[model samples]
Target: MSGGGTSPDYVFAPHERPLLPGSPATPAHPTSRRFAYFAIGVFVGLTGGFGNAMVTTNLANIQGSLGLYSDQAAWLTAAYLMTNVSMSLLLVKFRQQFGLVTFARIFLPAYVLVTAAHLVAHSYTTALIVRGASGIAASALSTLCLLYIIQAMPAPWRLKGIVLGIGIPQLATPLARLLSSDLLERGQWTVLYVFELGLALISAALVMLLRLPPSERMKAFEPLDFLTFALYAPGVALLCGVLAQGRILWWTEAPWLGYAACAAIVLIAAALLIEHNRANPLLNTRWLASRDILRFALVATSVRILLSEQSYGAIGLLTALGVGNDQLIMLGLVMVLATIAGLAASAITIDPANLGRPIFWSVALIAVGAFIDSHATNLTRPQNMYFSQALIAFAAVFFMGPTLLIGILRALVKGPNHIVSFVALFSITQSIGGLAGTAFLGTFQVMREKFHSHSIVQSLTLADPQVAGRIQSLGGAYGKVLGDPSLRQAEGAALLSQQVTREANVLAFNDIFLLVTVLSLAVLVWIGIRQLRMYITGVNPMSEVLAAMARTRGQ
Candidate 1:
């Protein structure tokens, strides 16, 4: 179990051991080593997130460059998530069986190779293959980030490292949006991949130069693990495809969507059935089916759905108004700062006795933020969203750490064997939650836009003097360009229709914002009621479970 050299004279605090079995034992470091670890952690974490963030934030531009349609661009994102989510389940065991060194050695080089492929191929099929590889690499890098962060901190502050490791990646989207405009302007999508490739190489180098301390390894994999993964991985991929493409292909319009959904259900169900019968299952279906775990999944998934107000709602609205990423630089800056603030706040205020309170506050802030955004007008720009978007951004990171810890505490309480189950559960809920949220909100916005467009068109009458006056005013703008009055009138009418469509889109986005607000508040109420019930019954579920876990680990 020991490494080649004498192990560092370091010890893990009881609370930290349950996080992962092969986690490096933390030796107290001098200020310089600590600083290096911190820097490496941030770099690794950001690199992991920024890889996908660059593609996702600039999907449209990438699509245009590759001569792809909307749905094709979507497949890139879906392909990434397909492997990213399912890989986490196998990765826990991979780390346990083979150790961090092997995990990184395999994946990091693969990441670089994949990035190189993306740079060279520049084709749709190649892009899909590379993205799937990137997803696996991304999962490894995220784990590496946490490992590095844990090494940086002293035992007393180790938990704070977890908070930062998880929360820092959330900043990538904003960072990507901030930098993508410049990257695209300079050298188009190639510049972006070159940058990612450079980061991949740098991350690999940094990790090699500063290796984590070795830990105990075990023969963690079983035959059934592979069988479960074989069944589960494709099932989740199919579901991810369904969710990602459903809105783009218009749900019922695509026959493939139905078939994919059905296949996903059958595959996942069969996997679960196999696990359900196994004495040593990978997924721990019964524990996951328990009330507390179900509730945790629901709350986690609901928060993800509500968080889409930023991704699908506000961003979509801005795009409709022709506001590009260049114009939203300040907004992205605000989000990054707010996310840092949230990370600090969560770390400082985390309490096992009341882990749910931050979630409450987070949901409240999201609701309030969404409500503020609901009143946006045609003139609304990125500047108009600064405060409200920051609130949501803060809440987004603020809630994640505690939610993760809650599940971790419960999983560790049961036993180390349940760790894989928790990881898989958390990954699926967050990934599928985001996907489903985007699909639902996007579809809803489209439907609302259609309704609003119909209503607005019906209300507009050429006989109305006001409408006539507006048409004349619009026509006057074209007088210098078009000699014929008939052509001018036609141009004016087309412009008016464009205006109406813009208005409808704005109205639809407002409705989406309101829906997010309503859902947030409703979830808040549901959580609050459950918390109150627990209090009245004199039973603190998480506290009791966490305490037992500590005692068991201590023993």
Candidate 2:
């Protein structure tokens, strides 16, 4: 007898069985039990993302509190992602071999212990170790979130549950921002770790209290799996390290960055070469490189990069404008609320027959928001950004569920073995894609800032009366302390230079917004063209695949 109840019908009907090995059984539950499952899903999803989100929002504060340099601080994020991005490749297999209940029990408790270690460990090395451990553990919770939500919803609404489950963690980004000022006030960076520890503890306890239904176990791992991981893990870590530190250290100036990049290429190529010959490969490189999968990967990665408009663009602009976390509380609140609405909207309106539509709308909404933000000036503040940011926030969660569903359905159509490959593709596109977006945009902004700075400085001449007068007015404020006329004039010129630098930064950010706007529109057009082609041809592979899925469930 299965813990979920009787043996699954898949015992007789193989076609309708769990899509992948060791996936949680979906037994019927009472109303109260279902509600409890939903509640746990929300909490665990929040916990999964809170650790990284809190650290990211308060990076500068954490850096100062630890006496770390700018480049050193970037490692904290890089460490988390280094492990986080590649774990999904193995996590599906872990669940397959062990079962979801065991998987949760193991990772959640380890999460608590690692978090506590972080609380006690003050050194940079220990912090990086703990952060990386946290990533491996938290990757499990996203799976937990999905399984719990599946148990909560009726069979018909399970897709909605998937949407909510995937999107719930995204809420943590803005939520962390909203709560950061208060948490830091409670204590320095330690309080943030303390808070994360508390969440991990509660989550661990909650899992022990209510267990997931039993899943059938399998002998999923091979000796070569370990070898593949050894090479692949470090390759990805090095790649993530390079991306995280490139702009901070300036790509060309850092010799190690070049060495790391070359090493990453070799290691990853070797791993894929090994997998390419395996009868049961961990990563299906050939499948991933297929035309349809390639398109999906492109869209997934590009959208994530463009979505950096909110994280690296809007937040960067406000920070440049001298706004602090405390001042931007309301903006964060607006994003949180808008994100909730987006999730709700996506869930309620999901059309399994037309999964691609939300992606189109998401890109369109982002394009519009970025266009609005491209017009910002020195006078712009968080309040000025409320609407555009809200629109982008709404679009952020709005597309996630549908995007995921498209991938999920497509993977299921390919058969059970492909599940690991799909998880890897999806996770990489979401996590690594976000990091790449920030790195690319940050580098673009810096280069543009230099360009604008030079252009603005070039336009200024002392012979221009307005320029000389502005300098005199700025220097006048320093007159009480510096009586020398030459000193006052020099001070005036310095102040003028500061204003020019600030304006140049603002202009550079506007260029980023415009670049994002154009990219978003182009992607939207590409998706639109594909949809148009499908309609005109009256032939669709996706329609056939969806029909197959419906037929399997019906049987």
**TM-score computed on alpha carbons, candidate 2:** 0.96
Give RMSD (Å) of candidate 1 vs. truth: 2.1
| lDDT (Cα atoms) of all candidates against the true structure | 0.88, 0.88
Off by over 4 Å in 1: 1-19
Q: Runs in model 2 with CA error above 4 Å? A: 1-17, 551-555
Per-residue C-alpha lDDT of model 2 across residues 1-555, encoded as one tens digit per residue? 233222454342343345557776666678999998898888888988897999899999988877899999999999999999889888888888877766876888888888889877788888889889989988988778777887788778888988999999899999999998998898878898889888888877776777776676788899998899899999999999999999999999989999999999999999999999999998888888899889998998999999999999999999998999998899999999999999999999998878788999999999999999999999999999999999999999999998888888988877777888888889889998999999999999999999999999999999999999999999999989999999999999999999998999999999999999999989999999998998999877678879998786676
Give RMSD to native, each candidate: 2.1, 2.2
Error of 2 at 15 (Å): 10
Worst window of 10 by summed lDDT in candidate 1: 1-10
